[model samples]
Target: MDIIGFLKSQFLCHLFISYVFIGTGLIINLIQLFTLPLWPLNKQLYRKINCRLAYCVSSQLVMLLEWWSGTDCTLYTDLTNYSKYGKENAIVILNHNFEIDFLCGWNFCERFGLLGSSKVLAKKELSYVPVIGWMWYFLEIVFCKRKWEEDRKTVVQGLQNLRDYPEHFWFLIHCEGTRFTEKKHEISMQVAEAKGLPKLKYHLLPRTKGFAVTVQSLRNVSKKFYTEGRRSMSAVYDSTLNFRNNENPTLLGVLNGKKYHADLYVRRIPLEEIPEDDQECAQWLHKLYQEKDSFQEEYYKTGTYPGTAIVPARRPWTLLNWLFWASLLSYPLCKGLANMISSGSYLTLTVFALLMVIVSVGVRRMIGVTEIDRGSTYGNNENKKKQP
Candidate 1:
């Protein structure tokens, strides 16, 4: 492996990267705070500026994935619809199975020029996940409690806030609500049986409440993008992604201590036809999962999905964007701080450090609190094991 890949694989490197990403993210967020006074004057301009700032910070990881790991990403899509990807606002429905699916989606957004404003309806716990989570806060990404009753209103409010956003964006939603596991799949299937819906072999039962609410909330305001529907928009929607097979020790994986295949599947559907009724939407989502399950089965059996094409991953301007901000912002901030400390502003420095520590701790605690532990069950083994 190359030196960058080697460095990425080391445990210390992991920590270092985490720190760099988080620290840089915090600094950028702070800069964004400096723009609060501008919100009243030109909300659109302020938002656009924030998107550029976000691009700078987030591109570091994208660079890591694209260059350091040397992983390959292949897109499968019809060429007709490639143009419309980042030109308008849209909702992205994705299956939640892999740890890095969000990263892949972000990569695609970057390719289509939507990286800066890309959003997701993520579990609230992800909001505390250091760099990425911290970055999402300023981007106005929606977070959900995953409890339908409590989340319904809050999530809708969050989505509504994006209606007037000046920039185009891709709002990702993992209707499944959690990463897939064998046990979770079984439990989801039981929920399916209880609801008299078809069981999915590849995906867990999506918490329809989230998908339903997302569509209902954003339908009037945002266009819906399905993996299959991108062609209709004249935007080439790529459906395949190359992931480092964590199960197999690629040189990169061995170094990085990651153990899961970076499997990705994407399709595009248009926004106009999304069902309005929650129940119908739920059934449609379940059926889609069943179809996806069948696709996975075929893929495993044949070592390729049924699709006929391979589309190369497109590298975006995210790296240059990162470099631009790092050069422009980091030096000025450092020099300013040095001057402040030299001028007897030690107390100010101390207070800033203390505030950083407090915010870090608070964010960490919030993450810990929001995570759902599915292992514990309230019933007997057989019944408990069947529910998640």
Candidate 2:
């Protein structure tokens, strides 16, 4: 390996990266905390401010995937839809397959200038996690408990509040609700068979109630969200992403300077086409997942999706943001290191070593959140029987 690549593999370099992320992230979180009062004064202005603040924390991960790992995200979309990507509001539907799938999506968000205001329907458990999760609270990210009875009321209320959102944003949803594993797939297919639905090879049966409710909440709003002539959400960006060479990408692999080629296929279906009734909407979502499976299967066979490939350019914002934080934090970090070394006590050294171990475990735990083996068992036979 070359000098830069070798350095990327070093624990010292990893420590520097983690230190910068946590340090800058906590500072951003503090800033977000100050914005809480602004919400009561001017909600729109507060959201705008939080959007930019959230960008600082999220774009660091984008930098790691795009700049450090040199991953390229190729957009397989029509030119017309591509023109409308960052200019309008929409609901984004994505498959939860690989660990780095969300990173790939964020890279697109950065490329198309949607990084700051982008949002997602994430699990409620994530709301309690530090840094990113704290950042999400300020971003107006919708969190669900994965229990329909408990979530139905609150989820609708949460989404309805976005009707008057100032800026254009893509509210992303992982319709499958959890990362795909072979066991989950098997169970999902069993549910499909029990329900008399067609078996899907590349995906799990989509949890439809969430998608149905989201569509219902956002549809046919008589009130105009943007008075300055900006549009409210009017379409669905049905996206399917796959990595070239069948590579199972990971956050750890990206951190270690591995490169990947990601191809994303997005279809801009008008919101009007989706059925309004809950049961019909469920059918529509299942059909959509079936189509997504076909696209994945086709890509595996032909090495491409169903449209012309348009390579999205990497934005410099993520890189620039990282550099700003690194430069600003370096002097204080170096000073602390020097002071610790000057003390030169065995206890201090032992404490430092223990801190390193803690940091290592913390990172692994964070990454474990996306691991298939460590994923939720929300799709088991018992849960399947409870499916509506």
Candidate 3:
């Protein structure tokens, strides 16, 4: 492993990186707040400025994943229609299986020149995550509480706001609502059985209200890109990272936040074909997840997935972005923080520390939930004796 990669693997290195990102993010957010007065006078200009600011912040992490860590991302897709990617607005349906899946999605966005504008229908909790969540707010990214009744109206309204966006965009949606887990999978399979639907070995039950509402809202305004559906979307699927030695591999790599061998299968489905009724849409989504499960099973056994040719991830813009942010914001932000600390503002320091503590606790809780123990420990001898 290289020196940068080695540093990334250490706990101290992760802590340092986290603190720097958090601190830098806090400063950027403060800068954003100062721009609030300008919004009422120039809404469009404010949005455009916000997008540029966000690009500066997020591109750092993307650079860390791509360049510093030397992670390889290969996309599988047909070249015939690749030119149509960012020319039109579309809804992107993706599987929520990995921690850094969003980052990979962003990487694709970067490649297609849509990094600044790509959005997602994320859970409400993510909106509080420092740089990423704050940036999403200005990008018009939709956040859902995940309750169908409560989320339906708000999500649709959010999607509607994107109709007149100045630039082309891709709205990503993880229909599963949360990341995949074995226990969740089992429960979802039970729900499927009760509903008389086929069981899925790879994914959990998809909460279709979000997808249904999104389709309804954007059907007239934009096109649709179903990553795992029939016809190909102009995007490509990059080869992700996977660890073979660990019993349960930590998703985070040294330089890369987390390693995932992502094989995205993108297809462009027309907006009109998406079911109209909620119940029908939900049923269709359930069947789709079942098919995704079968594909995953085939992949695990055969070590390959059915898809088109691979495309290399060559995002030079990511490097340029990192350099720009570090040059423009790094020194000024550091000086500002130093001055504040030296001024002896007790209350401000207390508030900052408290917020950091809360964010740390929340991140820990999320990681814990995603890492629930699922393996069995008892030997089969006892079971065999009891059966006899």
Candidate 4:
């Protein structure tokens, strides 16, 4: 193995990378706080600054996925429609089946120049995560508790906050709400049977409340304040993702330098086609998911999406950004370790070791997001539990 490849596989190296990511992320979080005042004065300028700051931290993981792991993300679409990506605002509905699916989503965001400003409908618990979650707070990422009563207001407010956002971004909504599993699928199928809907072979019954609320709320933005001669939500990007070689990519796999092939098929649907009423919108979302299920089945059976032939070129910016962070952080870290060792103080070494242990535990907890067995049972019942 090459030197970097060896480092990618080591837990100690992951710990060091996590240290730099979290440490620098915290500093950026503080800077984000200071920018709060700038928002009222110059909203666009404040947003632009935060977008770049968010890029600094987000690109680190993008590097791990693209550069370190060398994962290939193929975009399947036509040239005419594919050109619209990253050029305008859109709502992205995606399947939550793989642990690193969100990472793949981020990879696409990076390739299309939207990594710095992309948003998601993340669970409320993720807001407490060290680096990524903390950064999301400043980005105003929409967080839901999954309870219709509570999340309704939060989702509306969050989407409303983005109405005047300066940069173009792709807002991701994992309508399934949680990762897929057999038990969840069985439960969702029961719900489908109860509702007289078609059985889904590969996906869970989507939590319609989130999608309904998001579409309804963003619809208001479109009607009220259009930007750049277009509605705030100009299009909906229905993205279906699958892994090649039946590989289930995980955060640990990426840390260990496991290369996986990701094929994402995105279809652009106009926003006006979405139903405006809550009930009608909920039905529309359900239908969209059913179509997504068919796509997944087709992918498994034929290993390709229907009529999708476009795969965008991956960019080197993510790798360059990662190397910048590594170069900037590695020297100080090595110097600190050397000083601690030369001091001959057993206490310093002990404290350092203890900190490593704590951070390692934290990283494991972070990795829990990508573990299928460790996933929550949100959609396993006829009535979905509110995501915590």
**Could you give me the TM-score of model 4 versus the true structure?**
0.93
> Candidate 2 lDDT, tens digit per residue, 1-388?
9999998888777777887888888899999999999988988899899999999999998999989999888899888788898887889898889998888778878888998898888889888878999999888888988888999998999998887778888888888988899989988887899899999998989989899999888775664544544356789999999999988898888888989888999999999999998899999999999999999988999999988899877778999999999999899877867878999988878877887787777667767876777878856655756779
Question: Per-residue CA lDDT of candidate 1, range 1-388, in tens?
Answer: 6675565666555443444555678778788779778888987788889898888787776666565554455555445544556776666666555545556677667767788888877668768766667777767888877566888888889987776777777777666766666777787677778878887877877667777777776665324533323212111122433343323323234226333334455566666666788888877777777777776676666555544344445564755654555565557456756776777677777765764566555544433432333322312344765569
| lDDT by residue for model 4 (1-388), tens | 8887787889888897787777778778888889999978987888889999999899888888988889888888866788789998888888989999889889889989999999998789889876788889888898888677877877889987787887898898888877898887887787789789888888888878777767767654644365543347778899999998898788998989989999999889988899888788888888888899889888989899876566677788877876777788789778879989899798989978888888898788778867988778665444644235
Q: Judged by TM-score, which candidate is best?
A: 2
The lDDT of each candidate is 0.63, 0.86, 0.63, 0.83
Instruction: Name model 2 segments beyond 4 Å from true.
Output: 223-231, 381-388
Sort order, TM-score high to low: 2, 4, 3, 1
TM-scores for all predictions:
0.74, 0.95, 0.76, 0.93
In order, what is each prediction's RMSD in angstroms?
Answer: 6.8, 2.2, 7.9, 2.9
Superposed Cα deviation of residue 222, candidate 1 (Å): 11
Question: Per-residue lDDT for 321 in model 2?
Answer: 97
Top of the candidates by lDDT: 2
The better-scoring model by lDDT among 1 and 2 is 2
In model 3, which regions exceed 4 Å deviation? 1-4, 222-251, 254-261, 327-388
Query: Which residue pairs collide in model 2, if any?
Result: none
Q: If the candidates were sorted by their lDDT against the true structure, best first, what order would they fall in?
A: 2, 4, 3, 1
